[model samples]
Target: MTAPRTPILAGNWKMNHGPSQAARFFADFLPLVQPADDRSVVFFPPAVSFAAAREAVQGRPDVRLGVQNVHWEEGGAFTGELSVAMAADAGAELVLVGHSERRHVFGETVDETVRKVGAVLRGGLVPVLCVGETIEERRADRAEAVVVEQLRPVLASISAEQLPTLVIAYEPVWAIGTGVTATPADAAAMHAAVRRTLAEVYGAQAAEGVPVLYGGSVKPDNAAELMSQPGVDGVLVGGASLDPAGFAAIVAAAG
Candidate 1:
């Protein structure tokens, strides 16, 4: 039988949290999540804070660090973009590709994500690929189609062996940072669809090994119910993650 998927509780700090703030966050955050191992806790800090984050969690290897974004090329003059090697050198074990803000706000294209995913893998970091639909698409009842379309190219290109190392997060645009969240049922539906797509590319057995997370406004108050949903592996917390107490509570709820 296949091993059960270990829940991944990732905090995407986005454009928030500087070096000092990141150090302070781990001071209060680490105590609550560590000394146990039922789930994985990851921090996607901005590049500038990687040193502080890495040092803060020095003794805790269980706490994974990821870069918020990366450039597909190993090095060059991309202006403000980060390279996967640079992220890895900073203690990043994962990379976030195609987050909503990266796509909507920064114009991250599907082609970029496809190349980034390949680069992340080649650089020995797991890719937490984000795929979701916007308010307009969901309102038009095309949410699943939009998400599938966004993810298909990358999924089709990756080898079956690389599939299990990847994670998927569905953060609907309407629900992100607007104090809105997809209902547990709605989240589960989309997660199931993601798995179906994965299965199509790599067979049902291989797909089952991929962890699909529900993001958006995932607060502690609703975390348990969201985690209870079938196929809902864990969460990609946003604003709530910046708060030590609240984010700790959400991590506990995931357990």
Candidate 2:
């Protein structure tokens, strides 16, 4: 029987590591994740760390670097904003969009997130679009509505072909960084909802091929079970991934 597609284990070092710390982290991380072995390992660091991350991944065929966010514009003085071209020029193959922090803290609206996704694709970078329900929404039994709402604008402006390049990360707001994880069943239901929406909008082929991951306190102990659930392709790891050993164990747990 054919083996399942190798799952991507992506880690986001959000606002935590500076260029210097990034250098040290990658130096240690790259060796731990050999290209052929951990072929789908990706690291999404703060925008400022792009150059350092690129250098860290240089000549390493298996590993790739990504940016946490990027401005939708091509260029111009948007002081403090990193452009899509800048992310691509820095050798980042992917860019994360609409993370919870950006949504809640930075006030990035659905319309704006859609714009960035289009720009990321136009700039030749894959968009790992994240969506999820908040604690209140979940308690109100509106998780599905919340996720669908998030996807509406994001998919509205993009073409069908672009759907294949987009990866969805369903992170329940309450579960993130709270040392709480959605049970595998809980995650699978949301993943299935996202895929159903993709199919309805982009057709079956695109929806089937596009990978939807589960994020939110994914640790080495639970990574495998979560991945085993229907529609849970991989993960967008946070805290557990900060440590090289724990991150490696999460990948190894995938076996």
Candidate 3:
């Protein structure tokens, strides 16, 4: 049997928060959010403030530090880009690849994301790979297909042995930052599809242990209901995470 998946609540600070701001957030947030042994919490600060974020979470087992993005190449002339080694050196234990903004705004392709995933593994950091469909795709009745396509190449890059360490965040484009959240049933269905795809690529055992988190406008009010869904393992919080009390409430809800 597969081991039970550990629930993770990660805050993606995105473009917000500088070094001092990050430190302040930790000072206020550390006392507010207390994850249980079974739950894990991660903070993905902007690359610029990673060191401060790392220092903030120091000695806290439940809280982990992660980077927003990383370049696939180790080094050499990659202007304005952070490599996996740099991220790891900054005390990041995880990395977020294929975020929606990277794909939509920065033009990150599936192949590029695949390469980054490999680099993250080689760098000894867990990857929180983001996969989702846009509103247009969902309207066209191709949400699952789009997500599956996005996931295929990335999953193909990793071996079965690496499956258990991967975290997939399903953040539907339509729901992200729009104050609109997917119903628990809809989120569960997408998460289930993600697991099914993993099972097909790897084996059932490996797929069952992989945690699939729901993102996009996830807030304290809806956190419990979303997590209660069958395949909903955790959450990738956005705006709500920027606030200490709000995020803490969400964590409390998860526990």
Candidate 4:
């Protein structure tokens, strides 16, 4: 039997907090959340605050720090782009690749996402690759197809050895930041599809080890119900994660 995937409650503080704010958040929130062996609490602070965030989580093995985005190239003349090595130097243990904003708003292509994923692994960091369908695609009954297409190239780029370290978040465009969450049933169905796709690309054993997380409009009030669904191993929180009390509650709900 496949072991149960560890529940990961990752907060994506996208363009929200700076170093001081990040430090304050960790100081206030860390004490509120007791350490857990079966769960992980990750903070994806803005690149600028990565160092502070990392420092805040120091000595706490349960809490990990990650960067929102990283450039695929190791070193180059790319202006204002952060390299994976730079993120690692800042104490980031994980990186977010192909986030919805990076894909839909910033126009990150699938190939770029694949390269970024590889770069993160090469830099010795795990990757939380985001994949999801837009409202239009869901309305047209292409949710599964869209997710499959978005994930295929990136998953293909990762070798079987790297599969165990990867995390996938499914955040429907409409639900993200809109206070609209997919029903627990809907989320479970999509998560199942995601796992099936992983199994198809790799194998059942490898796919079972991967944690599939839901990200759209996740909050403390609904976190427990969502997490209880089949195939949903965790959550990638957005606006709700900005508040220490709110995020801590969500993490508690995950238990």
Over 65-123, each residue of candidate 2 has an lDDT whose tens digit, in order, gives: 88888889888989898888987877889999999999999999988898999999898
Put down candidate 1 lDDT per residue, 145-255, tens digits, no spaces. 999999899998799878878999999999999998999999999999999999888899999999999999999999999999999999999999999999999988976
Model 1 Cα displacement at 143 (Å)?
0.5
The sequence of per-residue lDDT tens digits that candidate 3 reaches over residues 1-255 is 667788899999999999999999889999986646889998898888888888888888899889999999999998999999888887889999999999999999999999999999988999999999999999999999999999999998898878777999999989999999999999999999999999999878788989899999999999999999998989999899899889998888887
Evaluation by lDDT, superior candidate among 3 and 4: 4
Q: Which ten residues in a row have the lowest lDDT in candidate 3?
A: 29-38
Best model number under lDDT:
4
Ranking by lDDT: 4, 1, 3, 2
Off by over 4 Å in 2: 1-5, 37-39
> Against the true structure, what is each candidate's TM-score?
0.98, 0.94, 0.98, 0.98
Kindly report the root-mean-square deviation of model 2 from the true structure over all alpha carbons: 1.9
Q: Weakest 10 consecutive residues, lDDT, candidate 1? A: 30-39
Question: Over all chains combined, what TM-score does candidate 4 have?
Answer: 0.98
TM-score, structure 3 vs. true: 0.98
Model 1 CA lDDT for position 231: 96
